[model samples]
Target: MRTDDSGALDLSDGDPILAVETLLLTRDGRPGGWRRAIHRADDFKYVFASNR
Candidate 1:
């Protein structure tokens, strides 16, 4: 998944919605991976990977 801005939200899944939602709330959010960016603070990369 990808977003146009830092505050944008993106989602990806290879499983059921219920399972995805559970992972989103439990794993991704807790580890700051769900709504977080991967590049450096100054980098303008647009790619976002969230299993949740």
Candidate 2:
């Protein structure tokens, strides 16, 4: 979760940001891993369905 530049949070008409990070060690015993992402909340729509 994140706040606006001015340090404010408002769901309505507010920009949403997403951030993720990953770290791992290779078989050779080397540490290396990093990931970052940011996007608006209403940028895209997602749908999920399931049947049982």
Candidate 3:
């Protein structure tokens, strides 16, 4: 989750600003890597999915 320049979580009438960092693992339970991601939302779907 993230906040605006004023440090406020204004989710209405504002830009979607959320930064997420996640770790990845290999199929054999090994450390694959990690990545930083950002998402933009302008709809009300009430669901979030990542197809990476």
Q: Count clashing residue pairs per candidate.
A: 0, 0, 0
Instruction: Work out candidate 3's RMSD over C-alphas.
Output: 6.8
Give the per-residue lDDT of model 1 (tens digit) for 7-41: 33233332212112222454545643354333323
Using TM-score, rank the candidates from best to worst: 3, 2, 1
Write the residue-wise lDDT of candidate 2 on 17-49 in tens digits.
Answer: 444456777899798666555455556566779
Deviation in Å, model 3, residue 3 alpha carbon: 14
Candidate 2 is scored at a TM of 0.33
Per-candidate TM-scores read 0.14, 0.33, 0.39
Off by over 4 Å in 2: 1-14, 28-30, 44-52
**C-alpha lDDT values of all predictions:** 0.35, 0.54, 0.61
Q: How far is 18's C-alpha from truth in model 2 (Å)?
A: 1.4
Please give the RMSD to the true structure for each candidate, in Å. Answer: 13.1, 6.1, 6.8
The TM-score between candidate 1 and the true structure equals 0.14
